[model samples]
Target chain A: MNEILKFFVNQDRMLGRNERNLMYTLKYNLKDSRAIADNKLFAKRIFKKNKLPIAKTLGVIRKKEDIESFDWSKLPESFVLKPNKGYAGGGIIVVYGEDKLHSKEGNRVWVKQNGVKIYQSDLEKHIIDILDNKYSLGGTKDKAFFEERLKLLKEFKLLTYKGIPDVRVIVFNKIPVMAMMRLPTVASSGKANITIGAIGVGIDIGSGVTTGGVYFNKPIEIHPDTKSKIVGFRVPYWDQILEISTKAQIASGLGLAGVDIALCRDHGPTILEINARPGLGIQIANNDSLKERLERVRKLKFKSIKHSIKLAKDLFGGEIEEEIEEITGKTVIGRYVNMNVEVRKKNLTVLAKVDTGADSTSIDSSLAREFGLLNSFDEFMEYYKTQKHESKNIESYHLESILDFANYRGIARVNNGNGTSIRPRFEVTIKIGNVKKKTIVNVIGREELKFQCIIGERDLNDFLVDVEKKI
Target chain B: MESFIQTAFVSNPTLFYYLLLIPVISSIIAMGRNVVGVKSYGFQTPMLIVFAFLNGSGGIEGSLFLIFVYLISFFLKTYTKSFNLHYLPRIAVIVSLISVIFLIYFMFFFKLVNISSISPIEMVIYISISEIFITSMFKSTGNKVAFLMFFNTLILSILAYIVVLFIPQWFLLRYPEIDILFIFITIAFSRWKHLRFNEMIRFRSVINDMDKE
Candidate 1:
């Protein structure tokens, strides 16, 4: 009941879909400006005219006859085929490279990111589908275009699942309001739409370091597929991303727009597309309200895009959080100490190891059982014992049933010296000194270890771990 | 006697009553969007549909006619989508099919009723409205959403029709001063900046997250 009361305090600061259309899109985006943003071909031309970096368009197929007459051999090893008016990253095909095993000379076969082989006839059929308005926004007749695919950056290779990641910056009134880096996952089929299960990592405007991430509308600390840390990685070319996004918004004549930019290995940041009616999922990604940020800069004027970018960084930036942290001094804790943790509505003082090297917290399996945190896991294990399911075969059935129980967050893959192991994660509330935080902790068999619980770097944000202090 | 004829409109004031309801209709549409959070086609579409209801076949039949037109156009669009024709030609075919359906309905079905009650201009307005509905429906993201918006517009138009019919014509004719109150109503809507009713539920997660911080 108290939670319900707190929700209404910030209700007015959140923007809904209806209010976004009624206030921002309808008022700021004129018909001609929206048309420019809607058509990718025209928007790319505008970006090129303004000297912004964008992928080069090789050819456009407007009709079925164009498909038959087009030269397939002229295409490079890697290219992207997309509808000119596709929305939400729909109807896009990416060719990673040529199939060395299947292709000979003139009849070269290409391989998709998912390892599907694409022949010349398959490409022709796809072009015809695009021309027939299969992937176009509003189901209108659209043209199919071949574009140069940007090479993925080295830092992002392990972070992304099967495709290149892109940064989406929302530029409103010449100010880059908020930005998020979208990484495609295997579940999303390599598309960066958050609704389709891609990961959205929030970035700090003042600093380029990623602050947090949201996958499927829930805050996540690690990538589900790659098991790599999602937060704390600094985005490359932050200033250039903001500059190109703002310039693209101005060139398209849209007062409020979202510019999707990809970081290429050779070219730096390149514009992917501009959206007139951007989605509201960025708010969930950043755990911030767009209405508040938008309203803060609504009436302000800027002399230039650079000035506005600076203003945005100063006003809605990570420095504000650091300032608050400075005022409230962090608590000092030793490497090994006894911490108070709340379990099943009771306070239990447990010996915990403060380790800053680990990214997530983990508790011993026996300690978790004593605290009643393993009720659901124990039930699943009991069921597994009866079925005699092997460890490798438990992937499908174990996760589905365990996820149905309360407090079971998800699965976590831990890489150690021996090998990789999968563990079930649980949400627990722990108090270290004066700070109480609700964190996700993985359950592992730590009977041989000295301490029962290990506090990781994630839960040690408000604490200074003194290695030499004797507990 | 000419001066008396000019001032005599005050005594028999049917025209003044209708002219006064125009602002009333505009106010209803504005309030419906700003306060009640009902999105119809647009400001003009619903207003024109209301006028068509008042001037043509009473409110019920006019609404029924609109539903019939939308249903025909929606199904015809689905049927003809496979032809792979150009956009304009496909719309032309859908409109042509709709026209034939209208011709058959008017020629055979309404033979018993007084068809002369509806003016030729009103018939043209109704037909043009069908085209507008079809275009707007195609512009939506999906068929389900388009149908939902169409249903909302129909309901709002019917509500406006009821409001127009129930207001005492004699009272409006006598007190033309009451129409000035609608100006203040419009101003109130223009100044509305609070969260709408639908927004409370749509941003529930955002609100909770903010509270957590």
Candidate 2:
């Protein structure tokens, strides 16, 4: 036993296929649980029995005869046809929508995810091949089934290709260990497998926000196609994702499993499939080790699925925050925050946009008027209205003395994309989260926008921005 | 070494000549996959292909014959897939088509090669190799990937064949203890838990990123 422990300790942090299979997969997974996990239809039944949301089955083809007998016309406009025991996301054809020009009364045509047109005979041939064990783990006979293709959630519509992006949560002993959001890139041919060209973005176990990403086994900070920052993108329905994954792990009776859950625009978080042996690319995405994590939680017990999720979060959560602090020594703040704007020796709670793009802080004119900070600006604007068309030069206005108030600092030149104008600036103090900063802010009329205040770059010196956070 | 083996080991040493190559073949396949990261069909299949090459008319002729069978079987399999036949029966169709093609080739083209070096059983071995190609084709993602896997298997088999040919059998015949050493090598390869060299290259970014800390 000591030899075994020493052997494990001597192994590297990165897990290869052999170590993963010998240690975790073969050791923890039973034959019965593995059988269910290998078959997608059986796993879906288990998920359905546990009251989990899964894709609705459209049809099932058990044998070659069923291919000819089954009504191919009844398939929905957008459905996914997959082999029951397919591995690594193979032999799955996702029909995005219907082809209008090729559909007759009894015969219809559909478009694949790659924009290839499929006829009724083509669908039948695919099912026949699937039943012939074309995509099974070995050469065993298998079944083919069709399920409703999930609609992409609005949050991930831009992040994914034609397919829905799913989150793969590796659960062990009923505890969620690690997770990464598998995004479909164009190069992956609409499949979300990392071995193919999809992007894997690691999700913080505690906060459900993306921490880092791996594309083609290398760390990437932005989505290759979308060019949006990959880090700090908060995954929607995160708690429910963990809960469903844990429950699916227990339901399938697999001690160790990778539960894939896709976020549907209509059904919310839905279970896609479960794997007895999950891939280890997630380690590169998180820049961490799965072997160490699995060893840490191997003997852990939990009260319930929710309790297990809570325990998992507590054990491995917000690691990115600590890493950022270590590297930059700055507090991390989100894109939108509620800040305390000082008004007449009191604090007014104002929702502010933390924009690193702007150079200085700006406030809405209506908010400044209600707070009595724009009384001098009203008189100055009245004098500016009379001299607007008369004088093109700043010195011709002769209003420098009128613009001088106790808090009024100077005029700021502002460009609104089309033209430039001057706005009255003031000295103000504001508190963002826990930190307070004294800065100069320009008062502008921004009643049409969402926030009344926009915090700019100069006041955010002591912070690093998490682009997707909300406080 | 040849006289010593004939005098001490057995009366007919020619019968044991092919048996001595088994361990060397296993070692080549194991080390090729475990260290160099060359994926093939499996250990036994590639080893059998190497034996077939050694038994047939040299390595190059056997490789060319295997490639011909694969291309014919590949096209026949793709063409027969639209017939909606079951997997086994479809494979049978491809094998039968290959047999007919071979019968025609041997009838007209038998004079192009030395007839004494090629046996009818060796011809059967070359034809049956197409079955492996067809099964992998069914499981592969597409024709391009199936071709790639077949190409890799062919290359690995050719490597093993070259080792068996150029390396004098007298060496293994004299140093019979080397077979035991190869068996130990195979055993040691099974217990290897380190990351493969290809995986090291695959995960270079992750490894380098961690090394900085």
Candidate 3:
């Protein structure tokens, strides 16, 4: 934690709350209000004017008279109805196709993407609600508009629960700083809102491939419902997506903006909305802070949107992969490696099995006791109890620091040959094939088991596993 | 002009004293909003001034009334989960419930406590407190946030009250035109794009880094 603080201090890359406010006050002009707030319709007009690809606007019902005079038959079979000033994903209705039985009543009924039937009257009432500004940011009167319902790309069909998934790209000074793909879930009620339980999968800004996913603010690998892997899912047309987002930022004229894009199976990626004050949830999704990214690009000059897009890709793209390689070096190891494991302040050389199946490394409890880690664990527990009594609860970060001192890191329920039992994890230093690293290893009652230690994939990321080679 | 100022100050010293808090309270709200990243309604300043004035006028009873109103409104908002009524109507119902509670308190408890010093202005202030409470309840997303906002507002009002009460009346009287300086100060505050004091601590690492660089 101190190192992270020192790193941020040394880098001077952390953007504070005041910096954000000052950036908005100094960089974002008052005239840019239309580009930033309650101006999705205005933003759409700007997109149309700039010849940017966007969902076609069938019609806009600004007032009651417009709603009455609007011809529902002229609308597309599948379309989206949304309020221009609607904040987040509120006041959005996605229609899949026109219901044939209700079409006899002259385009009065429609089928929702989630298979719910909606009548024309229900839509009109929703439009009335939109006009009432029920879903608007400030509850000001709003305009309801019909837009082309972009078909979900095949790659995202299995990943998204029911609603359309959209990618949010945070563009700062015409450069794309960060991007996250928001997937709708049943909990979010078909809306890609992180606060409402939509999955926020962080996309590699450079490569446009998903690096990680966070659901309900917790790191997750797969869709909770669909069970499809979210990480490493390469977003199609990455460069084009970045290009369009940059164009939207340039067109919007807001120095800081969030450009939302959705991929249409036929039309490719289309700009959905450009938010002036985009949310900070993308930070958690990417497991990276926005301050460093914003600070990196805030001062740079860009001749064109294309140039900026390329720069963003070059600078931020494939960072995770590079970081892995830098930390691990180009070392390769066999499936089984003879390693000197240090625990309880004692060292023992043991033949450790390298298993990718385990999420973490594990060590035998007897070996852990021999190293005096078990005694340290008891001391740590006493300290933790006193701290908890004093502070009511220890912060996760502080708890981590305490664990670090105690040489105990985590607790996990491990399934062994006998049964599943809870085990305490201890921090151990291991030297395998000349590469020495410190990692947390779960201490289990593995006295009955053959191998005293098992090194998992997490510890093995730095080394390529060669099953046939003997080390 | 001096005589006129003295007469005006003498006529209503409390109002004059509390009026000076307007700019101070406004600056506090502005700084608080910038630090917390929450939007401040236009009425928040006036609400604080009124709260401070009422507390000054009726003392403990006035503060108790405000606290009771806020608690009732917060509880009503939290417990009534399925009340899918419209925003205006929902606020109206909560306000009505608060009014009833106040009425009951005045009718039964007021006689027993015999705190007859409560002025008509204090009553009006108590009523206005409900409006601000309801508005805040509506604006905030959760009960905890609503309570926090209320607490922040309360703390600021109390601070303003302290400033108004403790500051020498003679100093204010002699420097009557100092109020104009407050307006200019407010304008400067509005244009202040610098990092807030809290932000300095929040981004201390960056500041420390800049210092080293």
Instruction: Give the runs in model 3 whose Cα sits over 4 Å from its true position.
Output: A1-12, A28-37, A72-79, A94-125, A157-161, A185-187, A195-199, A213-229, A281-301, A324-471, B1-7, B36-46, B49-213
Over 4 Å off, model 1: A1-43, A49-51, A60-146, A149-166, A172-175, A181-240, A246-257, A263-268, A275-281, A294-314, A319-471, B1-20, B102-128, B168-184, B187-194, B208-212
> Which stretches of model 2 miss by more than 4 angstroms?
A1-11, A324-331, A337-351, A355-362, A365-443, A446-452, A455-471, B1-15, B60-138, B141-148, B162-180, B211-213
lDDT of 3 by residue, A161-261 (tens): 88778999998888999999999887777778886789999888876767777786667867888887676667888888899988888888777878899
Model 3: CAPRI class = incorrect
- Residue A59 CA error for candidate 3 (Å)? 3.1
Q: Is candidate 1 or candidate 2 better by TM-score?
A: 2
State the lDDT of candidate 2 residue by residue for B1-213, as single tens digits.
Answer: 666766755665545667888998999898878766776888877888887877778788888888899899988987986687766778888898899998898789879877679867677887887888898887675577788888888898999888888666666666777889889998888766667667666655555555345
Q: What is the number of backbone collisions in each predicted candidate, taken in the order shown?
A: 0, 0, 2
Q: Which candidate wins on lDDT? A: 2
> lDDT at B116 for candidate 3?
65
RMSDs, each prediction? 11.1, 6.5, 13.9
Would you give me the overall lDDT of model 1? Answer: 0.79
- Please report, in order, the local distance difference test score of every candidate based on alpha carbons: 0.79, 0.81, 0.71
Q: Please give, for residues B96-185, the per-residue lDDT of candidate 3 as tens digits.
A: 777787788778887766556666666656665676676656544445556766766665555556555655567776676777776776
Q: Which ten residues in a row have the lowest lDDT in candidate 2 chain A?
A: A3-12
How do all the candidates rank in terms of lDDT, highest first?
2, 1, 3
TM-score of each: 0.59, 0.78, 0.65
